[model samples]
Target chain A: MLAGFELIKIAFVGGLISLDSTVFGQFMLSRPIVAGPVIGWLCGDIKTGLLIGAMIELLWVGVVPVGVGVPPDSAIVCIVATAIAANKVPDAAAIAIIFSVPLGVIFKRLDIAHRKWNRVFLPVVENGIENGRYHILTFVIWLGVFLSFIKSFLFLFICVFLFNAILSYILPFIISAPALVKGLQVFMFVLPVLGLASFLASFVK
Target chain B: MKNCNIIRTFFRSLLLQAVWNFERMQNVGFLYSIMPCLKEIYVTDENRLKNAAMRHFDFFNTHPYIANTIIALTLVLENETVAPTGLPSVAASEETKSQQIKSLKLHLGGPIAALGDTFFWARIKPFCGLIAAGYVFIRGFNNIGYFLIPSLIFIFLYNMPHIFFRFFGFWLGLKYKTDVVKIISNFKIQKISEIIRLAGIFVCIFVLIAYIVSSGKYRFAGVLVFLASFILIKKNVSIISVFWGLVIGCVGAGFLM
Candidate 1:
C-alpha cells in the first residue's frame, strides 16, 4: 500500500535504472542482482529484493546481447517483482514475478522500436555535420539519454500500477486455497532450479 | 591532440550507443566520441573537418567499454591522414585514406564485439553473479549487510576490469594503432573466458547444493524439479515456458500431495 508520491519516487529510480541498462555508461546498475535489491531496500524489504533479484539474475545469467541480438531484460523482471512483492506479502510474489517475466521481452520490443525511431536523428545529425554545428551531436546524445529515462519512467509507473491491480484481483484466488498456498511455497525453489538450468545450458558445448 | 581534448573524448565514449539506430548502430556515438580530435586536426580545413565528422558518422558498432581501443586507433589513423607520412608512407589519396579508416572500423568492430561479448557479457558477469549468489546462499538473508556486501563485490568485480579497459585501453590503441589487434589477441581473451566459465560452473553447482539444502522438507522435490528443468532447458525449451510449466506443475504437485 504505497502512496502515489512513493510510486512516483520508485518509478523515478526505475528510469535512472534504465539508463545503465543501455544507451549510457552501462555500468550495469541496471542488472537485476544490483537494481532489484536497491528497489527492494527502497521499498523497505531488503530480503524480498535480494531474493527476487537473485532469482532473476540466475535465471537470465546466460542472456547477453551478442552482436545485434537484444536479450530480454532481467532487470525489469526483478524491479517489478521486487517492488510488488516487497510492498505486499511474499506469498503473492511468485505469481507477480511470473506475470512480470514477459516484461523483459516487452521492454526488448520497445527497445527495438525506440532504436528504430532513432533513425530520424540521422538526418538532423547529418545536417549538423554539414553546417558545422557539431554541438548538435552532443545535444542528440543527451537527448537520447533523457528520452530513455522518460520511457522507462513512464513504463515502470504504468506497470507498477497496472500490475498491482491485476495481481490484487488474481492473487486472492491463488492465496486463499491451501493447495495453491502450498504451491506458492514450493514455487520459491522453482525459480533458482530453472535459473541454474539456464546457466548450465549456456555452458553446454 | 591536447590532454584536455583526449580527456573529453574519453568521457564522451561512455555514450557510445546514445543514439543507436537500426540503420547504423553506434555511428552517431562514434562520431560524437572523436569529434573533438577531428575538430583540432582539421581546424584549418573546414571541408576536412566536415568529411571527418561524416566519415565517422558511417555505420559503426562495437562493445561500448572496449570501444576506446578502436577510437584511439582511429585517432591515430585520422591524424596520419592529415600528415604527409600516411598509413604506409606511400602516397595515398585522402579518399583512400578515409576509406581505409572506414574499413578499419567495419572490420574490427565485429571481432572486438565478439571478444567483448564473451569476456564481459558472458564470462566475467556470470562469474561475478555466481560468487554473489553463493554468498547469499551461505549467509542466508538475515541482515541487510548480507545483500550489501555481495552486491558491492559484484559491482566491484565488473567495474574494476572494464573501467580500466575503457580509460587505459585508449593508450593501447594509441601506441600500437593497427597493431592494437595483435596486442589484444596476445591476451588470449577466449582462453580467459573459458577459464572463467569453468569457475562459474563450479560456483553454480555449489549454489545449487546450498539451495536444495536450504529447502529442508522440499529437498527431494527440489532435486527432481532441478533435473526436469535442466533437461528441458538443455533440450532447447524456452525458459519462460519451462518456468510457467514448472510453476503450474509445482502448484499441482503441492495440491496433489
Candidate 2:
C-alpha cells in the first residue's frame, strides 16, 4: 500500500489526469502516452511510464471514442500501471499492464453507466431552460464534471491501493523466476509491434 | 463584435462535451457553446432565444474536434437567417429558416463524424503515436529527457492538426458556408491518411528489425510472433485477445527455449 503522502499525491494527480477523460479538457493529456509518463515522472520512473504508455496507446490506437460508445479507459490503465512500476517492484510493470487492461474495460462500463445517469438530469435541464432558470444549466454541467472527477479519484485510489498490496506480495516470487522475467521483458519489447500492426490494420481496406 | 462572438463560440466549443449524456450525447454542451451567438442574435427577444435554445437541445454527437465546423456553419446559418443583409439567404420564413438549420445539422453531422474519425482518430492520432513509439524504440527510454521527448512530440503533432482543424474549419465555415465540404474534399484526407499509414508501417518494421538485431536472440521468435499477429489481425481477431495470446505465446516460447 502507498504511504499516506504518496496516496494523496497519486489521487490528486490521477484526479487531474482523469479530467482529461471528459470533464474539463479533452487535451490529449488523458492519452496513455502522456498520462503514463506524467504519472511515471511523478512516481520517479519515466522510462516505465513511457514504455507502458506507448504500449497501451498503440494497442488502442484504433479504438476511438467516435460516437456514443466509450472506448476502454486507457488513461486509468496507464496511471495504475505506471504507479505499480514506479513502486519499483520486479515484474510489477508487466503484471500491472496485464491486469490493467481488464480494469480499463470495467471503467469503460462505468463510464457508460455515468452517461446513463447523466440522462436523468436532462429533464431537469429542460425544465430549468423552459422556466428560464439558466443557472440550472451551469449546475448540471458542474455536477457532471464533479461526478467525473469523483469517479476517477475513487477508481484510481482503490485500484492503486489494491494493486500495490497485491504486487507487494507476488512480485518477490516473480523476481525469483528468471525465465518468467525474461518472458515479460520479451513481451514488453515486442508489444509495440502489435500496436503498430493494429494501427495499420485500420488502413487495410 | 461578430468576430468576437465567433471566437467566443470557438472557445466554448472546447467544452462541447462537458455535459455529455446518453440521451442526447453532446447536445447540452453544443447548446451551451452556441448560446452566446443565439443570445447576441436574438437579443431582447426571450421567445426567440427560447426557441433557438429549444431547437439546439435535440440530439447531437460528433467528434468534438470536428464539431467546430458544424458549430461554425450553424453560426453562419443562424446569422444569415436572423440578420439576412449581405449573405444570400436560404428562405424568408422563420419556420423554414429553422428547418433549414436543423437539416443542415442532420446533413453535416454524419459526414463530419466520419471525416473527423478518419482524419484525427485513425490517421493523425495513430501516426503521431507511432512516431513517438518509433522514437522511444530507436532511442532507448533510459534518460528521462529522452522519454519526455516522445510524449512532447506526440502532443505537439496531434494537437497541431487538431487546433488547425478547429480554427481553419470555423473560418472555412464562416467563409464558404456549405461549400466547406468541397474545400475539405479538395484537401484529399484519404491520400494523406494512406501516406501516414504507410509511414507508420515502415516505422513499425524499422523498430522491429532494430529490436531483433540488437537483441540477437529473439529474431526467429519475433518474426514468428509478427507473422502470427498479422494473420490474427487479418482474421479479424479482437485486439485484446490477440494481445493476451501474444503474451502467453511469448511466455510459453520462453519456457521452451
Candidate 3:
C-alpha cells in the first residue's frame, strides 16, 4: 500500500545502506542499529525505526562476518521491517520481524553466490596482470560494487512491495482482534531480553 | 615524495576487500595497493617487477583495518630490497629479502587477526551498539528525536577507537618495525574489553527492568520468561531456538492471561 514514490525512496536508501556490507567502507552503516533508524527517518517514523533497530541489533550481535562464514543479511531484515512498520501497517512490524528473519538466510545465499561469481573473474584478473592489462583489475572491482548495488536494490524493492501487499490483507483482522493485539504487544516487549541474552552468550565463550 | 605513496597506500587499504575471491581472499586488492610501490622500486627491471607482482598473488587475508600496518611494514621491507644500505648484511641477498618479507607477513597474520577480532568485534562494536541501544531504551518510545541520538552515538563512539587504532597501528609498525607487537601488548585491550562487557551487562539489566515495570498485566509472566531466557542462554542453547521459544511462550501466556 506504499505509494510509488515511497517505494522508490526505500529502494534508494536500501541501496546506500547495502554498501556498508561490502562495496564501500564496511562502516557499521549496515548494522541494523543504524540502518533501521535511517530507513525509519526516511519514512518519517523514527519510533518504529528505533524499536525495530534495537531489537534486530541485539538479536544478531553475534553474527559478525568472521573468516568465511556468511551470516544472514540482517540489514535487509531491518529495512524490510522498518519499511512495513513505517507505512502504518497494523502489527506489520512484529510480523515483518518474524518473517524477515528467514529472509536473511535467502539474501545470505545470494551473497555467497556473488562471492562465487567473483571467483569466476579471478583467472581473468590474473591473466590481465600477466598480459599487463591492469585496467581489467579496476573493471573487476567496479563490477563487484555494481553487482552488490543491484542485489540490494532488487531485494529491497521485492521484499517491501511483496510484504506490504501481504500485510495489507492480513493486518485488518489482526488489528481488530484484541487477543492478537495484546499478544503481539507482549511479544515485542519480551523480545529484547532474548536479544540481550544472545549478546551476553557471545562473551560466555 | 615517499610520504605521498604511504598515504596513497593507506587509502587503498580501505578497498582491500573489494575484489575478494575464494582462492586468495584479499590477494587481488592487496596486489593492487602495492603495485604502484613495486612499479616505482622495480622501474628498471621489468622481469623483477613481474616477479614481485606474482609473489603477492598468493593467499592473504586479515582484518582490513589492521592491514594498513602490514602494508606499511611491507613497503618498508620492499624498499630495503632496492636500497640495501640500511638493512643488515644477512638480509642483503634478493632471495633472503623476499623470504624475510613473506615470512614476516605470514607470521603477523594470525596474531593481528586475533587482536583485530577481539578489539573491534568483541569489544568496540558491541560497546558502541549497547550504548546506543541503552540510550534509546532509557528515552522510551515517544521521544521524537530518539533515532538521531543513537545514530550519532553509535557513529562517534565506534569510530573513535577504530580510527585511533588504525593510525596507531600504522605508525607503530612504520616506526618500530617488528617491535609493533610489543607496542600493541602495552595497550591492554583485554582490560578495556572487560570493562565494556561489564558496562554492557548493566545496561541490559537496566533495560530489562524498564520493560518489566512497563508490563501491566503480563508483569509476572514477563519476569518468568526473562529468567527462563537467561538460563536457556547460559545452557548454550542456540539463539534462534531460544528466540522462537520465548515468542511462543509469551504468546501462549498472553492467551491465558
Name the top DockQ candidate: 1
Native contacts recovered by model 2? 0.57
Any runs in candidate 2 off by more than 4 Å, and if so which? B84-92, B143-145
Per-residue lDDT of B1-257 in model 1, one digit per residue for the tens?
78888888998988899888999999999999899988998889998899789878899989988899999999998888787654554435777888888899999999889889889998888778777766776677775465667678789998998898787689889887888788888888788888888887887888888878887898888788888888888888888888889878988988897
Instruction: Report the lDDT tens digits of candidate 3 across residue range B1-257.
Output: 17777676666666788777777788777777777777787888777777777778777888877887887788778877877455456334877889888988888877887778777877777767777776776677676454577888898888887787777777777788877778788888888888887877777677767767876776776677667877887786767787778767766765776
On DockQ, the stronger of 1 and 2 is 1
- Per lDDT, what order, best first? 1, 2, 3
Better of 2 and 3 by DockQ: 2
lDDT of each: 0.84, 0.80, 0.77
Chain A TM-scores, one per candidate?
A: 0.96, 0.93, 0.94
Which portions of model 3 show Cα errors greater than 4 Å?
Answer: B84-92, B144-146
Model 1 alpha-carbon drift over 4 Å, by segment = A169-172, B85-92, B143-146
Candidate 2: residue A72 lDDT (0-100) = 85
* C-alpha root-mean-square deviation, each candidate: 2.0, 2.6, 2.5
lDDT of 3 at B39: 77
> Per-residue CA lDDT of candidate 1, range A95-167, in tens?
7788899998999899889999999999999999899898999899999999988988898899988887788
